[model samples]
Target: MRFFEYQDRARRRLTLLLGLFALVVVLMVALLNILLLYTLVEPWQELRRLMPTAEMLAEHRGFLLWTTGLAIAVIAGASLGRLYQLRRSGGGRGIAREMGGDPVDAEPEDPKNRRLRNIVEEMAIASGLPVPAIFVLERELGINAFAAGFTPHDAAIAVTRGAIESLNRQELKAVVAHEFGHIRAGDMRLNTQLVGILFGIEMIALLGLGMLPGRRARSDPGEMRGPVWFNFALVAAGGIGLIGGRLIRAAIAREQEYRADAHAVQFTRNGDGMAGALRKVAARYAGLNASPAMVGHMLFANGAIDQLLDTHPPLEKRLERLGQPLDEEGLERLGREATDRVRRAVTERERRRREQEAAAEQRREEEENGPLGEAFGAVPGSLAAALLAALPGELARSARNPHWVADLVLYLILHPDPEIREQQLHMILETRGPESEERVRQLRAMVPEPAAEHRLPLTEMAFPALARLSRDEQRTLAGLVERLIHADGRLSATEYALGRMLIEHLDRRHGHGGKTTHGRKDPAGKNARHRENAARYLLATLALHGHPDDLEAAEAALIAGLGRFTGSLPFSAPIPEELRQASQSAAWARILDRALERLARMPRHDRQRLLQAMDDTVQQRGDPTAEQRELVRMMAASLHLNVPLPDAGELFDAGH
Candidate 1:
């Protein structure tokens, strides 16, 4: 099913689950009221002797109403308080820290952490999502991990030390993929809500225990001890409610785990990797030393072994689902084989480490010999490699540091004209203080002028750190970016692209941003016209920007792009005169801005077509310019497309 479908279904399931929790609360309140009537309300102590009359009922009605109201208020109040706490803590990153996780550095010194970071980055790039902030539970020695967040934009992935140290590369990849599955299926949001609900239910038991009778002076011979019995009854009701809550949470969590496992297989296309990881988890099961009642439902495996309340399915059962059912004897053999593989892998890794060190030293020596010698080094092959080649080392390192990232962003968007740049620097000083302004100046001196291609990659690298900022800080940074972009009084395509990408990404991470709702039924009538006009505006912008000197070429490129959506759009294609008038209007920027807002809501298939059309427009005049490439990347980011940035060769060949 599509992501939006899963999201809608999850919402329905959440409502049902919450209703079950409410039923548990109602039962507890009923029990409390019964205790109050039987123990406290002394109405002649004889309901059997009393007449069945309206006046008799009216006499006890007030007392019964008071007891029920108090019980509900206590329970509902506790639940709302827990929900408030979760909200204040800032979603996934906050949950990770609360569970004793430390943020993994972008350039980690530990080899294992580095490996985990690389794997996450690779998966994120392929999945077309922002790279989630990674954290390590340094104290946890259990093979477990979890994804937490309200939405994909703010998601965080955390793994224990044992998970990284025990699992090999493929096994670790499978585990991470399983968590990503949760993010994609909208399980993280549901898991977070479950945490709050379970906590509220458990509060009844805690309150009862707090109120239990303690050592007291000897009571007089006829003193009432009914309150003592009342306390015990409260404890009993609370215990039953807690158990019911756990059962409900576990049932829902078990089904989610199975779905996540299926997603892992789909993502990796290898069942053995996930199956192997599960077997190892079974063989080496160490409990997580955290609040099991609150976090268990979100973990990769059940943290404890309560059969009736375990959040994960049995390991054997999970293996069976993965097409690797094994008896005890087979499990033992697999465990032994896994141990042997780890030993061999360690040795191989050490050898590769040494080789890499030698290669790095050789490159340093070559780089020292000048550009000619540097050219002898390995050629840029992949997107990552090309980015590294284009970005200066200092700028790249700065992008990874949260302290310097905001400054880096400011420096990248400074106006090219000296007078305008000085105005921007002055604006930064007034708004962000002298320290920030100085940092931006220092960055400018260090890089002098970065190439056009390096801008987006640098911004992309800064995302994890950007996510670390508080909401207010992100908003301030966003404001600063906007002002700098418009400082020259005219927005370049590059400037609009860069500013839009930054603001949109930060907005989503703050949990208030609008998410793409793909696979929804297409809009009809007026809405359809609006969408068509938005598409036209975008295509016109790209064509005019790419071929600024030649109007004939611009019109041809525009037509070529529009042809991709010929049958799909609601309205007819615009003629050359219309295109010319639209491109020449002074309100072109405002039009493009509105167009982007509309296009961002396009369905998944429509988005893919739009991207293809963009590529066609860029390659209409042989090779695309640097400015053209940057604009395309920015446009894709603005639309929240999951695909990687297309290269020049891909752009040229995409038209066919």
Candidate 2:
């Protein structure tokens, strides 16, 4: 449906809700009238009877009492029907069942619906987003998908089984990416709120119905004559409330679909693929709709959005809104066009990225000898390779819990103090730790005997033991350790320290030096010198963030940062020239800011690093110092820009 059509429908629904609220007020009034008759007229009738004026009193009260009671009873019957609709339109269980997912995570899994899970993972990697929960609809043949969740971390995407089997990888990616667009753009929050408000609109009518019985029960016997008039107004009010709410929810949610569709196109750079996917579903309309009642407001296209009844724009119109051709012959063209268009787009994007990387390399070389250079940019190439290699494997696997790998990151970072190393060794010696003799034997059995550790330190042995697991298993295990370290809020200091250490150790054990020359520039090139300078500047900025008060601590931070990055890409693996530089600058800048902000917030500590950065700054430039220059370097990296060298006067002054 066209996005605006959904917006219009939601407005209409809200209007309906307002109308229904008025009806509920009227019904409530009718119920109140019945009670008033009992409390006022019926008692007065009895009073008149004792005074021998019964006939006069009875005639006055009878019509009004019966009228009020009748109005409430009629409204009750009509309101019950809306409740059934309330259940259906809510899309609560129908959606859950279709997705083969339980609203509650503890529900047993259905073995038949695993495809939904796999598609979500692939799309997430392609789009550079974390994976979302996937659900399957066993009974649905409709090619429909929706993204839902309160937050990105908890978001869910559900598609029918037909969607998976019917669409190829690209189309599936298009659809999933569309859903993520909704997730990213904050449409899901708006969507969830619509559901909540619809429920609130119903609450008033339900309360009105609940009050009806009590009104009837307490009426005085034979006191007031029934006047059916009051009850008539009551019933009219309730009907308006029910229909009004359905329109409101449908209206608000429908409009975002177009935005989501366009976002999917942007995300995949394949308009025709997304358009074609929609076109294919529209062509198969006969078998592609859920029950109108089940998908009423939740679907991409309404099941019942016939020209006359639907709140959404008609299907042909929606396709046109996306500039897609309606016929089958055109769909094939769109498919090929989309593929080529995306390939070209990807190539261009990669090219722009490479150029940026090359420039960053030059900047790094220029900044390397600057006061802050060494602390700034430098990641080992091997770690970058591992990250790239990990991506394909991570995407292809089923039963992914990347969080498990994330958790193990802390373990991988394990470079414990000597005491901690000894403790690790003793734990291994106890024959209880997993790194003990038996595990070593198992490792020897699995790998070449030459590669097995017979006399290595326990710290060294622990990592290879982990790497021997099947790739997926290793990810899972690493993810577990990471989880433990970061269990609450941020990872504990000890955890962070250890995780980095272990990461370095593992890289070493695998004969993988984190350093690589993939994106390094030629030595004689001017750009090469600039790139070297940028790395040095990046390190200095990071070293400052570590609150290094002396050369020793500053040097340590430089080592850690260099060790962490060095010859590798800051984030991704297989460093392109443009990305490596941009990454080096971007990462160095971010970590610098983050680290500095962390230290800045802490109470003044007399730690060696703290004293080091302080005294070192004072010594470099006397008195007020070039702290401002350092600040500029720190901030420049944060903005992903190289700080042009200022003259000596700009950096330091002896005026004081």
Candidate 3:
């Protein structure tokens, strides 16, 4: 099924869970009634027969009322206990965070924490969803994890630190991707519902225990007569209810884990990553698949191992389903191997990142200035004419999409000389008419055309202005134009200089002193104010690049760059039709924040490359929107500089 289809299925499953709960409740009531008739009330009947009088009959009725009340109290109390468990467990990190814990610093510095953060960002890009918040489980040695959230928008993925250190890149990717798949597929919603239902089922067992005490609190009544009628009645109900709830949990938990594993395999496109992970678990602790305490059936691997009466099928069986023969390797070997592969993956990733960074810096140094009068000369006249020819058809279709054109206009305002944008603005104002002749006449000078209108105007207006952001944010902001050419990884010298020049113009417009720290005259580390302003300028410049000049988006980006470290949150413009479109959301923002946190101390070139990569991804989807552009800009700004700065609004129209 498509992702949305799975989402729908999950929703339906939620209803199904409710149905099951209702069914169980009915069964419990019926069972209680039958037991009460046969046991507690039966003794009353016998006593009444012995007394042979009206007063005895009345006493018998009173005894029956008390027995029913006791049953109700037991059931209700159990229900309450289960609720209490859920309440206490809210926003929980399960066992991982509790054991491994967080470091003392405001920003995370732990290696394991860093790895987990990186994996989540990588997986998010791979799967094309907003990065969800990532969490770590430190103490768990054997492999296990779980994705928890109320919805995809608010979801979090938590993994064991052992799992982080153990799994290879692909395996780790496969694991994180698997959890993302659960989120994208809406499985988390259903899983949460299942938890609630299971709680309800357990409530019955609680009721049984609660009533057991009622049967015993009969000191006066016991002396008058054997209180077996009340005592045994309470015990029976409690025992039955508790047993039923446990059975339901076992039934629900096992299947979902298997399904989640399949999803992991599907996402990574490598059966080995997930299948290998399971093998590692078995070998690590002699088939110890114990779920964490109080987290039964909740972990990625079985927190508690219960093979015989457990919900999960055997690991070998799960592997065989993936077409892998598990018997070939011993379990411990697989575990260690999987763990080692993940570490190597992390190292290689860091290496490639460094190279990309170095490459970007080299380009920036070569062409250290923005294009002058002749830069537009680089454009071929034919391509410009062709753009003119296609403008009308392209314009009419997307003009109504609300978010479509606005981002591009914002981008233009950011890039190019202020005068260039003002003239483009004049064109926009002049060509507001609908007539083809009027449009053609206006377009005559702009392009060598039978004439362009919205399309040509929009493109010419958008790209150059957006190039004002740091190269990465510029690349991302250009996401506004559907077919706009974009270069990824390292920026060309021309692109680098173009970005620097635009920032210069912005400084003038915003009333900041021009190039306060620049050139050979001002060596590095000479000016603290310059350093502070420079960092803040870069953060604002990067974040506001493609944003629609909005306060909230700009503020968010600034905070991300210099704010406290937190889980990955989605930060892209909310696509109206969430289930259908693949777009950024608060979930992905968390991943982007982690990326920024890691690179916070890095130089601009590396920061630019990663941010651009995000933009490249959005455009690769065929046509990037304004919302996407804004998000990328914000991310680029926030990277590696979680330092506080003025609000995004104080900087530009984006802040406004």
> For residues 513-535, what per-residue lDDT tens digits would candidate 2 score against the true structure?
23321122334323433433344
Checking candidate 1 for backbone clashes, the offending pairs are: none
Instruction: List the candidates ranked by TM-score, beginning with the highest.
Output: 1, 3, 2
Ranking by lDDT: 1, 3, 2
Candidate 1 wrongly placed segments (more than 4 Å): 1-19, 26-69, 86-102, 149-155, 205-237, 266-270, 291-294, 327-330, 333-398, 407-460, 467-476, 487-498, 504-656
What TM-score quantifies how close candidate 3 is to the native fold?
0.46
Clashes of 2: 108
| Tens digit of per-residue lDDT, candidate 1, span 103-199 | 9875564578877876665455334456688998877766789888766677789998878878887788789878877776667666666667666
Worst 10 residues of 3 by lDDT: 370-379
Clashes of each: 0, 108, 48
* Candidate 3 Cα errors over 4 Å, as ranges: 1-22, 40-113, 125-130, 185-228, 286-294, 303-305, 335-656
Between candidates 1 and 3, name the one with more favorable lDDT: 1
